[model samples]
Target: MKIKHLTRALILGALLSITGAMSSCEKQTQTQAQAQDGQYVKKGEGALSNVMLATIQSAAYTPTLPTKATIIESPSNVLSPRTENDNQNQINAAITNLSNSGGGTVLLGSGIFRIKSPIILKSNVRLKGGGQDVSIIKRDESWTNVEGRGMLESGGYIEDLTISDLSIDGNRPESYRMSNQFPLFGIEITIDNGGTTRNNRVYITNVKIVNTGMGCHIKHTNNVILKGNYIVGNGTLASSTHSLPTFFHNVYLRSIDKAWVYGTNYFKDSPGGNGLNITHLTNLTVEDNIMTGNNFRGIRLGGSSSIILVRGNTVSSNTDFGIGLAYDETGQPQNFSIIDNTVNNNDNNGIYIPNNTKNGEVQGNSLSGNSPLNIKKGTNLTNVSCQAN
Candidate 1:
């Protein structure tokens, strides 16, 4: 009789535990539903009266973090000739496998990997190749890039990612020639947070990208580095117009914060737009790069950029201005320093600054042989110094 009483007690305890678990799950579901009802808060730096003052006071932002410690399997045969008809599936499978195992590296071997779809990138992963020209990623003959996606496109909110030592021939002329489709891009990453939150810590080094709309088009990111890359001959629409559309660019950055772009060689850039275009950005340092033979401006900066330092670069022989800073009604560009650059032989002005810009300095630059006027500025400049050009 005592044993029978103990069994009944055990059964009663089990039922109570299950009922409590159900209640806990119901509360969790309700919390999730509430959060999904437009209540998710994006992270950001809190309110600041003076933006530049806040930038000066805050600690430096760094993005060289590797999230995982384990080394997952590296599929060297992801897109080799052996994986011919199953290139997309094999590549996705490898990436998914690595992601499921808590994020790792995708080691692409030396081969021409052809794909018909965009390769999704995950956070905490390094996509490495066998040095620059060994691993080439090209689009297949039957490929049609839906929604104007890039050859290597990153999804939402990725961080601690590095892509190095590869060549991406995005929709090369032969492939697009057959399909008559334009607007192909190489290495496009976008994160939409409206300046509330920025995707962090992306480094693309020693990569070569060519034959696309733009070599690198990044938006709303933080602490990015584009170093030692060769980007060329973008805006591949066979046109002879001097004024290419502004949307086409070789290296386009928008709404970026804290970027370091250096040692990039952009040749014959953007049959449609500028070689390097920066807009709505802050704390950008562009140095030691060569931008030549572009169809449009060599480097164009506008859209309320702030704290930009353009130094020690060569910009020459473009269809339009060498380095241009235009007016933006939303907010004028502040603390723009054009120093120690070689700006020569462009079709339009060299270092053209429009009205309403503030606290600018153009010093120690070598400007010669530019059309219209070299170092032209509007009369409404405030506290700006243009010396020794």
Candidate 2:
């Protein structure tokens, strides 16, 4: 009996030891699984990771304007001075000297200064004024031949300048009497020549441009913001013999890579003109603008391509179509969006998108006092919602 009791105690002890070993193995397996699942904390930060984080943070902020600016003030004379009779050379010399030194502001004091020749602007220069009503730059018709030569030329980086509160009158003899008689405007601002420097990152605000063959001309530029400016076509009263209709465009943009024209007012009493003429551009945004009584189309985008956004603009009393877009020779206008615009009282169709255009979205545009058809002859048009008001 004693031997049997001793054997039962030994068997119970062996069973208990086996159960304890199994529990220890299970705990070890759980710890190994957690390690395999990447549950460890990081010890040090990486250089590449920190750099990427810093780049993202910096990109979120708006860039600040340049610190130094040059001021160009007009001679103190209430009456307009002729380019030949007045100290025109002195003024041009001052402008050239300041721009060559570095980019700074050129202040125009209160007066009317008649400019016979086009004034050139170097890189990083700002032409400012005391007040829009106080300062004026009038063009002499005799010097109109220099229209395309550019009133301001930029060599290096041109950015962050306010050009407003001044009037540019283009009714002088040198400006008006042209042999070619083409649609040439008063001021030409351009950025070209494959320079590393970008051109015309300028803010044109609250200026009145009157009697100009074309008010403001921009070419080969980027990030040009035009706001709160009044652009009017030259009236027929300027010409007596020809009886030719007034040919003026409030703003003409040609071959610009990326541009925006917003919150501007354009009006023309005579016919055969455009409010805004855009040609050969990409990534253009036109919004919150008013175009009225234009003889030609309100906004004409000629042979442009890639990501054109026209939104929240008002087109009224235009003799031709309100908005017109044409494909380039290569048929390249792929993506265009026209949304939330009020187009009324146009003689022709409200919106005309030709068959050559592809991948367009026309939505939430209102049409009134004209034909019911807002869109015409376009393929691959999706999500288009047009309603008559």
Candidate 3:
């Protein structure tokens, strides 16, 4: 009778253990689903990167719109001397004519074109140049505000625009430093002041932008592509009364959607500058870029940004965290994937997720020689199997 009783107790204990284990696993799976929120629902293991890469490669290979028959121009071909007035007039003429004719390319030949005011881009007009080393757009010191916007501004509510293969020297020389109006960026794609939605379907590539308050600033834009550009903020040239490092970022994007920032290089000589500053964005992919030697973070997603993929980038040698996720009082960063990157040599954490930021994956990254990954807040955190080397 004693032996039979002992056997019954053992059987009951084993059954309970199995049931408990099953319950625990179910809870874990629920948590993962909640955290991921169906972002990677159809993505198989080890294939997420491949899928995203294919999308990028295809996009780069086959542009959705027609980009043939570039209209080429040059100082040598246009009126001679190609002073600030000459170059600006020629380029503007080409763009205006093309836009009026339903859009085309305006290619600039190898030369240094001094621009004293904004080069406005109209709908369906592309501005191409000789290689960055050969074609230069040097900002004239005498020039200040282009309708209170950037050196190269865009037409309001424009679409199918391309700016590629050039160098823009902001020339923020000591004489040109005005802290109040400091961010004299090389390119600024802005929505019309009173318009809610403008500036859509823009592409920028193979450009070298330097010595500016900000290299490139895009606001309220959609379907943007910034690829193979070298954006550097050499802060030594300008003196800001407000702060030591006058420059803010190499590239700044806000209220942008369906954008891909790939194969670009962003760096800064001084501290307190960001390689890329993103705010209130959606459906964005930032991959295969080099962001290093900046004052602040390499990449920052602030405000109410969602559906982001950051992968295969080398972000290092920064003063602050390598990759940072930020949120405002009413916003929470969500639906992000941080994978397969080599982020190292930063002064702060490799990846930072503060309170109010959740629903993300940090996996398959080689993060070393920096502050460890920090998950400051939020529950049901889905780390998704990271192997830190």
**Across residues 1-389, which tens digit of lDDT does each residue of candidate 3 receive?**
99668757755654454344323311111111111322432534532311211001111111122122233332122222275344677788888887887777777778788877778877877787778878888877777663235768876677887888888888776544334355577788887665366567888889888877777888887788888888886332235565334446778888877778887555544334688888888887888999898877888888888788888899888888888788776485677877667888788777776654556655446666665443223335453222222
Model 1 per-residue lDDT tens digits across residues 79-180? 453356346566667666776667777777898888888887767667777877898888786886443678888877777778888888875655432222
Instruction: Report the lDDT tens digits of candidate 2 across residue range 134-231.
Output: 77777655564653443333433455544666777665344443322533455567666663545656667777776656677777666676777777
Which lDDT value does model 2 have at 86? 39
Candidate order, lDDT descending: 1, 3, 2
Alpha-carbon deviation at 128 in model 1, angstroms: 1.0
Best by lDDT: 1
True-structure RMSD, every candidate: 23.8, 19.4, 9.4
Per-residue lDDT, model 3, residue 329, is 65
List residue ranges in candidate 1 displaced over 4 A: 1-86, 174-181, 193-195, 236-246
Please identify which of the two predictions, 2 or 3, would achieve the higher TM-score against the true structure.
Answer: 3
